[model samples]
Target: MIYVNEAADPRLDDFRDLTTADRRPDRPGGRGLVIAEGTVVVRRLLASPYRPLAVLGVRRRVEELADDLAELTVPAYVTSSEVMAAVVGFHLNRGVLAVADRVPPPTVESVVADARVLAVLEGVGDHENLGSLFRNAAAFGVDGVLLGPGCADPLYRRSVRVSMGNVLRVPFTALPDWPRALLGLRRRGFTVAALTPRPDAVDLRRLPDGATGRVAVLLGSEGHGLSEQAIAAAELAVRIPMAPGVDSLNVATAAAVAFYELTALAHPGHPAIATPRPRQRTDGGTVGQ
Candidate 1:
């Protein structure tokens, strides 16, 4: 590790003033670097496909990554916490940061080619929600994530930290054609199910369990949910049964529930499936009181 006491060291430019550094290159004033914070995330970044640029951290934190850095030729700049805080533009309690150049995401066709279940997102622009959704997707063995329009870049620094770096592991790509691209998935034998709160939708738990065939769960933004055009493109609509007067769930939380349900239905032996939910009637009442 190279020791540096100066915050203005020319080599440390990649980590300077990070608040706006996470923007995509297409956005104004963006470098499009994938930044991983803390040891856990930094380690995952190192293992990810993105090429490592450099690492900036305190000496202790840098030493902790010795094994990971042993074979890597990139520079690891070790410095005091004060210097790190100044360079990073904020006092980072995690004390370690790693930066990498963004790589091209896999093609949607490639991601869908070998997947049993996938998470298809639309208008989920919140970084934390996107990150949490990915973490849930990884937790439930989701094969991949397909980004529809109005989605945020999952590689943003906040997203990377929030996802515990699972974004780096999850294969995702943009579907620039919006709802039209969903037709391609349907043609490929995927049952595109849009998750919505409409009264006419099928109850999520009521769907057949231990089912066969590929499924894609379409999710929408927290504010407005899925667009009508997008929902119309789906093969079916499903909803999680909730208490009366409750409208919906946070998109990521709703996704976790949906992912778990799908996984349980497809693979009954999966350990994370919860206890069976009570059956509900078509009129929104409990069955066989």
Candidate 2:
């Protein structure tokens, strides 16, 4: 571990002014680095495909991650909480941070080639909602996520934290050409179903028996719901039955309900959705990410 007494040290540049660092194009040093906060997320970053660049933390937080960092050659800067706060420009209760370079995302065909279930998104620009959707997808055994136009960057700092780092684990790729590319999923035998609140839409719980096999769930932003073109492109439209006064659920909550229902129908008795014991980490701590 390297001891850094000063906050302005040149080596700590990556963690400097993090509050404004992630704004794309509008801010200086907004180069889009993959940053993980706290020991849980930092450990997840260490295990992810992204190459770790450096880590900055208080001594106690650094010590807690010793097992995970033992084999890594990345620099671990040790400092007091005051110094860290100065560098990051805020009081970060998470205590530790790790940064990694962004890597090229996988192509749409590659992410979908061997998938049985997928979540396709359109105009989901809210980072927290997008992250929560990924967490739900991971929980229910979604094979991959295909991003249509206007989705937020899943690797954004807030997204990574809100997802509990599940975004790092789930495979996602961008789908170019909007609703037109949805035809590719049809050609590959996926029953693309759009989730909407239309009165005439098929009730989600009563999805037809023919809706089995490979399936793709199309979700849109919470505000406008799906576009007319997107709804028309899908083979079927499905809706979650709700109380009379309720118009719609939050997008992420709606996704969780849909994910559970669809996964139960698609892969009955699948281990992913079954009750399980707490995950044990090799380092003896319970795994949270």
Candidate 3:
């Protein structure tokens, strides 16, 4: 650990002016780095496959990561909160931050191999939605995410923050050949189901029952939803039933519901699906026979 009194220390350059376009890895003139905010996300960054370059935080926040930093040889720069704010161009309420170099993403085939359930996305350019989808994917034991065209970079800072670091854990890769790649998934024995609000879509609850195969739930952007071509590529169209006058749910919110249903459909015995426990009465006996 090194204590730095000045915000201009060359060692802190990676985190400088984070809100600026030039500092955003997904934008022009930006360095391609995976940045993690807060101790929770920073801990996940350290645990991820990406290589940590350095860490910058206030004294307390830096020390809180002592165990995670123990085996690392990278510099952990400790400074006052004021210096941290000045260096980063804004006050980061999360206290600590870590920056890492992104490793190459896994291939689509590698991610798809041995997977029973996947989240396939198209035109999901919104980072938070993408992140939330990843979080839901992680929560339900999704094997991987297949990114179609118009998808945002999952490693972007905002997505990383919104996912609460789950983006680091979920494996994802770009899918080439546009909607045609989806056909490839089907050829690999996947039942590609496109999610849409179209009235003709099959109710999610009515999906054909069988836990004996792979399934990919394809989602689209929040605004336009799925394209006709993408929908055409899918083997089936599915929808979450809604009340009168309701057209659809938010992409990420819809993803959670779809992921839950699909995970149960594809992997009935997967550990994330917990067995229901008996409820007990206040008097200590079971509530029902």
In order of appearance, the predictions have TM-scores of: 0.90, 0.90, 0.91
Assess each prediction's global lDDT (C-alpha) against the native: 0.88, 0.88, 0.88
Per-residue lDDT of model 1, residues 1-289, tens digit only: 8999999899998898899787556644564688999999999999989999999999899999999999999899999999999998999999899999888778887999999888999999999999999999988888899999999989888888899999999899998788998888899888888999988898886764323368899999989999999999998899989898996899999999999888655544455553444578899988652
Among all candidates shown, the one with the greatest TM-score: 3
lDDT of 2 by residue, 1-289 (tens): 9999999999998898887768646433555688999998899999998899999999999999899899999999999999999999999999999998877889887899888789999999999999999999998998899999899989888999998888888899899988998888988899999999999999997899877678899999999898999999999999999988886888888999988888766675567673433568999888762
RMSD values, in order shown: 4.4, 8.0, 4.6
- Give one digit per residue, the lDDT tens place, for model 3 in 101-193: 878889887999999999999999998999888889988888899999999989888899899899999999999999999999999999999
Q: Which stretches of candidate 1 lie over 4 Å from their true place?
A: 24-31, 208-211, 268-289
Q: List the residue pairs that clash in candidate 2.
A: none
* lDDT value, residue 83 of candidate 2: 98
Q: How much is the lDDT of residue 247 in candidate 2? A: 67
Clashing pairs for predicted structure model 1, backbone only: none
Give stretches of model 2 more than 4 Å off. Answer: 24-30, 274-289
| TM-score between model 2 and native | 0.90
Worst 10 residues of 3 by lDDT: 20-29
In model 1, the worst 10-residue window by lDDT is 268-277
Candidate topping lDDT: 2
